[model samples]
Target: MSPAGASLGATVLCVLAWAGLAAGDRVYIHPFHLLVYSKSSCERLEKPTAEPAPHPSLTPAPIQARAPPVDEEALWGQLVPAAQKLEDGDQARVAAVGMLLNFLGARLHKTRAEMRGRPGAAVLSPTAVFGTLASFYLGALDPTASRLQAFLGVPGEGQSCTSRLDGHKVLAALQTAQGLLVARGRAGGRARLLLSTVLGLFTVPGLRLKQPFVQGLARFAPVTLPRALDLATDPDLAAEKINRFMEAATGWDLGSPVMGLDPDSTLLFDAYIHFQAQMKGFSLLAGLRDFWVDNATSVPVPMLSSTGTFQHWSDTHSNLSVTRVPLSDNAWLLLIQPHRASDLPQAEALAFQYDLPMWTKNLSPRAIRLTVPQLALRDSYDVQDLLAQAKLPTLLGAGANLGGISDRELRVGQVLNSILFELKADEEEPPTESARQPAGPETLDVTLNSPFLFAIYEQDSTAVHFMGRVTNPLRGV
Candidate 1:
């Protein structure tokens, strides 16, 4: 134990500790490493592709102007029963589907956020988007089918037709994902959420689609209606007809009608989803509250407030705060806000560009007095437009093989997915003077008075059903 020996050992320990920290910092992996295409895949995608196999023809079910009402009880009964019968490798398939959904959802959200000079609130459903994509996969052939299988992160890339993943099975998994969200909301005999999704196929008159393709739509959505319309001859009128039909079918005035109908488009596919949730113990505060749209601009919007111990995380390095609120027993909402009001876009970019689900993993329980805007957001985007924005316009273009959907020359003009998300605090009588006690000093006050981002995810599967950026609560984009 000489002084020289002690000093040498201390110096060595310090160096080792510093080295450990440096190594830890350098051991970082990008979230999208596995999802993005490799150099070879990109090169292969650019090469000339083979033609599609001849599609079989079947008499489609009679076109109906109005789809029958969905029996919620029966629908859930069927979905849950099948979900319980989890086949071997089903977990992997479900996880793959969820990962793809999150990846696509992030890309679509970032695209929408940057589309305008000033980003507006945009809402999208990963479920509906995935369903729309799955529908296309159902009808795709050859290279297109294999390409889609890769894009969707599903197995079955063999050259033989038998190797293609079954669309029915994929769609059924999607329905089961939806089922988990809704079933968990209703787990405690409380109707916290009401979710309805429909698929509308508007085609040119006399266009014959495969019976299996039409029937397979039902496995994903409760209602699938095919109607003959002149989408090419009268784009405006066709848009009006679709708007009215969806309104009548879903009983929710989506606020805006369908737009941007392709003039030459023979088929227009629409997936409309309506989601409403009532937080169990939240209360609607009286009068309108000032929601800062920017540093200077403010708009009055209805606000909801609740106090509870919720999972919360604040990333000082990223200058953001995340709050998790229970939507149901197994589904929760993640609210991400920039610490600085003006940094919303940057915060959003950071959240989506890298790993978002990773943020959820860091959250721990904290007493919070949370106030958020009453969200009534409706957003619709053409999947084709999204594809184009993502630099793959020809993925579903005219040359693509969608022979499985129709027998004749088929061109998918538009695949639009519309989403409506409404969140409200349950109605309650005004609090009495004595009952309205102030929150304790230890309670963290988190108010979403500025632009922010959000997502709703399933617990077990980690499926992100919805993702959005709320720049303006009043806009409801």
Candidate 2:
């Protein structure tokens, strides 16, 4: 399969393949077995099985902090070819993962808005969040894994091994999806995108992590940093140490101190992503623009201006308009802005209710002079908190089976993922002569001067990679 086709197939298989096979006594299954279907596997599925045997708790292997994993290529090689046959009944499940991310993204923004008691800037990543959950799924066994698979929209087949979903396939699909984004960014000389992901794991002293589990993380994050610290001693000190380590590793000061540290917790997980996209069509405006934060208040922020024919749609029933702009050959930025009279929160609530993917499909080309604020946004939230918001707080609780990750009982304190999205106008070259045409009677001026919602989509799969709300352009830089 071509690289592009492989990415699309992988994205489509994320959820469907998870429901393919159940976990037997084995801890890890090669993603290849789950992705590539054969007559032999089908025949095995047809056979009846005796009573299921309980798998003993897996033994954790000791390894030093920042140790290089052995056989990295062998583990990652399974994700290649990327394309796999997706059953007809399971096709819809292909989009299940993306839709879940959309729902969570909406919830994430809503939660932030409620916390501040006002509209606020928030950014959530579908890829990072999905990958983080999938990584945990790799370490989860039986009931915990089943719960995760269900939440991820994987359908239950049966009680046999063939009925269980493979965590490796889910993770491999995540890698391909992310790879597609990176590959898209590299094409088209006029555009540039920088996306980097890092996973940070902090463990209590003498607590060992499974080597296989750590090795599997290579499917998504290129860098995995594991450190052992005295988390039970002083929460503040521990937080400081974690912050310093992450900052040094990623060169991003997360600003706020890490919160919700449990003294008795043995493990903490944090995933960080830095994403920046720049395209040639838009040019930075010389002066700041007034962005109304509310009916009466406004803030001055940097702005970018672009004039050309672009995909655009105005929702007649609702007080919002949708605009789609190409960031790369394989990606688009869809902007949803509310009318001047409507508040963003109400518009956001209404916007999420509509089929978001349809917005991209329904867009029509129109001549537009678009003005949007230069954005630099960041937000971090705990996965546990997100589950609580989803009313599944105990999904990762003490009783959860994470034996694949470690042998001893573990208290997982936090599962946090931080996202940073930066969109800047490329000013290296002037706009093409056609784009610089003087405003005419047919040109419509659309300015995102107020709080609005935005989503980044992978063109091939039409999957939402990132969803966010921009209340103030300068808030989370």
TM-score of each: 0.82, 0.79
lDDT by residue (tens digit), candidate 1, 390-474: 5557778888888778876677887888888999876443422222234788888888998898988887556788888898888
10 residues in a row with least lDDT, candidate 1: 27-36
- The parts of candidate 1 lying over 4 Å away from their true place are 1-64, 69-88, 154-163, 187-190, 353-355, 427-438
Write the residue-wise lDDT of candidate 2 on 1-477 in tens digits: 644233333433643443242223223234233432245665775667796444343222222333443232322233323324344523233344445455445555565556556546777786777788878878998777766655554433234455556666566656655555545454344227666777888888777787778888877677787788888889887877787667766666566547658888888888888777885579877667799888899999988888888899887677788998888776788899987545577777776531356545668999999988888888887887766655566668887889888877878888988887888877564533332444788998988888888888765444577877887887872
Pairs that collide, model 2: 18-165, 21-164, 21-165, 22-164
**lDDT, each prediction:** 0.72, 0.67
How many steric overlaps are in each model, in order? 0, 4
What is the Cα-based TM-score of model 1?
A: 0.82
